[model samples]
Target: REHEPLITVEVAVQLTDAKKFFKVPRTFRVMVCPGATVATFREVVGQDLAPSGRVMVPRGKEAMMALQDSEELPDKVTVTEFKGKRQVYVKFTMAQCYKVLSLLRGHLEKAESQKALHEAAIEVAEDEMEYRLRLSQFLMTEAYPVVCRHFGLGCDGVESLRVIPAGMYLVDQHLELLELQLEVETLMKNRGTVNFLMGKINELRHKFGLPPADYPPHLLNFVYSQSLLS
Candidate 1:
């Protein structure tokens, strides 16, 4: 048995109705890795208890519900002891099972999207610092919310913006204007591009309910000069 594959275990899930009554007291067997998480078994069992499809059950009245009720599935599922056997056990109404399947599907899609975006962001970043910052921002702003939503956790979904001040985005704009002013440069007459970038910064701030960024003194002078020149 030394080189044998890891033995798979049978997880028993008992089917019940929303009322916690043993509508179908029989245990259904699902094969999975011994160390698999409860979520894994839930998915396996959910598929076996597929809604809107026929499963081979002896009793003719054992019709699976087309979907699960939202209130039926618990936030966390764990293996509990039953009749002195060390086996995983769960109970779900047909409606609850369907709901679980739908939720799992949506969660998988969101997780995949997060992973794709993270990889793409890393590739697109110009330097290591940019990649790290962008990755962290994506995780906090996008991935964290997706996870929180799936787990029914309270999330404001503004974690990244909360950590990064509104003025940070405008810092480069302020510096550029200051440099132009100190050099007495007048080659860049139109402030349209600067205004557009500022507009975007303000739009982001408004969307997230963040305070408006204040202009640095030198930058303010440049804006004043532009307005007079225009």
Candidate 2:
């Protein structure tokens, strides 16, 4: 059978463990006589690729068939038999295997840690929303009514007093109401002072036998208005 014609066959070195990380396989080609024993073919392939590994062939669609030492290479062996196939799976030495395992473990741990942090952030956001909701409810239902009663304002006044949209936080509205109260108090004080001064001026005009000074209608009305008092 030494006179048999040589056949070319494709051979790929399987990166099994490394492929899980790198995802690339290695392939090459070799010429062999059909009469050669599987062991001899494996030796020839191993010498060029991995010195220590088993040679295999495609069994079916998804299975690899390991070639036995005593078996002979099929007479019709062709490149298509091993093309894009995992022809030989090379096993890493013990040390290399351990290093790959360690890397895999670290990657898994990091993924778990990231997932845990994401879940924690979601929980914190939920809690904050709940607190804001509770605070807003208290301001609207309890605090707002009390503020309205204190200022002698009716429901319409409370509605009109909102300077911000209803969707916004009620705390800002409460602050705006307090500012309005302060402004009202200041206006009342200023009006009283103006009235007193005006009365004194009129009295002086009367003693001098002159007519009272005519102030602007808007100013007089503003100083004497009683809307806020009611």
Candidate 3:
């Protein structure tokens, strides 16, 4: 109202009690009544030039409300903005301040819940990626040699392999050995091997506070023996 004394109110980033909220050089500034309650103050902060008044915000009607809700807002504080161009002021009765604080408390709890959920989701994704890498490494170091021995293929220093020997130089013997090697490679790459390794890796990963690894589909098609040859 025109009869009301307009006390300049400037909302600051430092006003947040904990966990610094706003990062940039920005704030909410408006002239509000010294007699206004927190509820009225909220309305003033959200009001734009709907009536085409001097209170023109940078964005629109909802700008201050959006900024206020995003962080822990200060209460009944007096400060200065732009040294003197904007004067920071707030005057709330104890009862009104308490009510606003209660509402903000509930909002903080909800914000914290949202933050925790987001962080948990990211942690799950990163842990799964690490699990896959570790599982692949285990297969190469532990399972590959076992597969090679079963197929009678000689692994050279855990590196390359000697081709299946054609004993007696018989073509049939050479083809049979080749077929056996291919079968061994297929089994090593089967989904069963992935499932087996997941079980082993989960035990170690979980011990280190990481989430358990799920049986991955991509791992089922990753041919370790063929990759080694390549």
Each candidate structure's count of clashing pairs: 3, 0, 0
lDDT tens string, model 2, 1-230? 01233354556555555435576555654445456676756544443434345567777887777666788765322222232322322222223223322332343245553354334335445353443344344335534454334322233223422411121222122333223322332232234445655665566566768788676775577566752121
RMSD of 2: 37.5
Q: Note the residue pairs that clash in candidate 2.
A: none
| Model 3 agreement with the true structure over 187-216: per-residue lDDT tens digits | 333334444444545565656577765434
- Would you list the C-alpha lDDT of every candidate in the order shown? 0.38, 0.42, 0.36
Give me the displacement of residue 188 in model 2, in angstroms. Answer: 99
lDDT of 1 at 133: 58
**Candidate order by decreasing lDDT:** 2, 1, 3
lDDT of prediction 1: 0.38
CA shift of 112, model 1, Å: 7.5
Ten contiguous residues minimizing lDDT sum, candidate 1: 1-10
Pull out the clashing pairs in model 3.
none
TM-score computed on alpha carbons, candidate 1? 0.19
Q: Indicate the worst ten consecutive residues by lDDT in candidate 3.
A: 160-169
